[model samples]
Target: MNRYQADVPDGLSRRARSFVRVHGLRVGSLAVEDYRSEWLERGIPSAEIDRVAAFGERWGGLALPPSPRYNGGPRFFTPDTPETDPSGGWWFEAGEQRASVPYGFMIGPDGEFGVHADRWVPLHATVEGWVESLSLTYHARLWAKSITKLVHDEVETIDLTGYVEVPEVVGLADSWWRGPDSLVAIYRGEAECLAFPAARTAYIYSGLDDWGLHG
Candidate 1:
């Protein structure tokens, strides 16, 4: 049972079509443990790890060190390159100020395009299993929300797993929040929260009432 379908129209680039199809499934099945292991195996420097951890702390409210392997490997979006600017997009400073979160979108060699956000959480290995499961589940919800929002008002057709024309408005609607209470609330509230359609546009709205955070 293929879980997703794209609503692409004609005249779209072949790469775009390919991007939609490949990502449609890959994004849903992405695993956090797999991501971390790949990072370690790649031998990313400790300094980079510290930098990533600090970035997470300042932006996402979590302390996540960069994986040992800094180069290309399996990642949600391409791993950050030295040329990459951490200050742009949803980095710590921007997310804190309520600026728009940067979603990761890439055009494949085949010209297909996909969107994703690589997320890292500060979880010890003892509980790594639980963390991976939770992250995959969250990724699915986030993707769904983005898709739904993209075609919400119009009945436009899209290919579930193929490329489609880029929408004029591509952006995330929410911010990422970090904190013990926020994390717990998001987990508890996952069922009720709407899924995101694309990678970057999805927002992690914290402070739910049911989690006893507000009450």
Candidate 2:
């Protein structure tokens, strides 16, 4: 069995699996019972409990390499512990951030993953989206003939007229779009969350074929 399959639930996408094969760090899973009482006391809904438990069993304690744009990626906490959000939500301390803006990374009650400062800011609708985005990025970097980066106002210059959003990533502030022969990725998580205009960024990957995109 693949390393991810050993503990991950529902499995991962082909590209995501490839990324894990190359960059994933395997760790022991934490059973749902490990955090049951704590989660219950926090008033985490039963449905949310199941989701968080599954995430803990699958990805907890494992750290991926830094995201292509930042100094650190998610480093999940073990046993799926959650802290009550003052905003009347429950959240898990997902990981650390090398970037100075946010207090840290957080997985919100709705499974949205992003950074938490004064409030929870969702970057992607699901943690799986983040993984998928990472996988797509590495794949694009390997196969694209050229890569271009844009920051802040420059991001608005790229016209995505013919591109369609990649649905698998379930993006919020971060998203991916695919054109006929290229892909565009936009990241607005940090900038929007921290109100820091300089943090807006985007990447363009050109000269890719079907194999490079989906293989």
Best by lDDT: 2
TM-score of 2: 0.84
lDDT of 2 by residue, 1-215 (tens): 66543233345688787776677776554677766787778777777777777767666766565787645555544545667776787787665565654457778878888877775678889878888898888889999999999998999889999899998899998999999999899998888777888899999999999988775
Q: How close is every model to the real structure, measured as TM-score?
A: 0.18, 0.84
Model 1 stretches with alpha carbons more than 4 Å out: 1-49, 53-78, 84-150, 154-215
Top candidate when judged by TM-score against the true structure: 2
Q: What are the RMSDs of all candidates, in order?
A: 19.0, 2.9
**Over the full model, what C-alpha lDDT does candidate 1 score relative to the true structure?**
0.26
Cα error, residue 88 of model 2, in Å, equals 2.3
Runs in model 2 with CA error above 4 Å? 1-11, 28-32, 38-51, 76-80, 98-101
Question: What is candidate 2's CA lDDT for residue 211?
Answer: 83
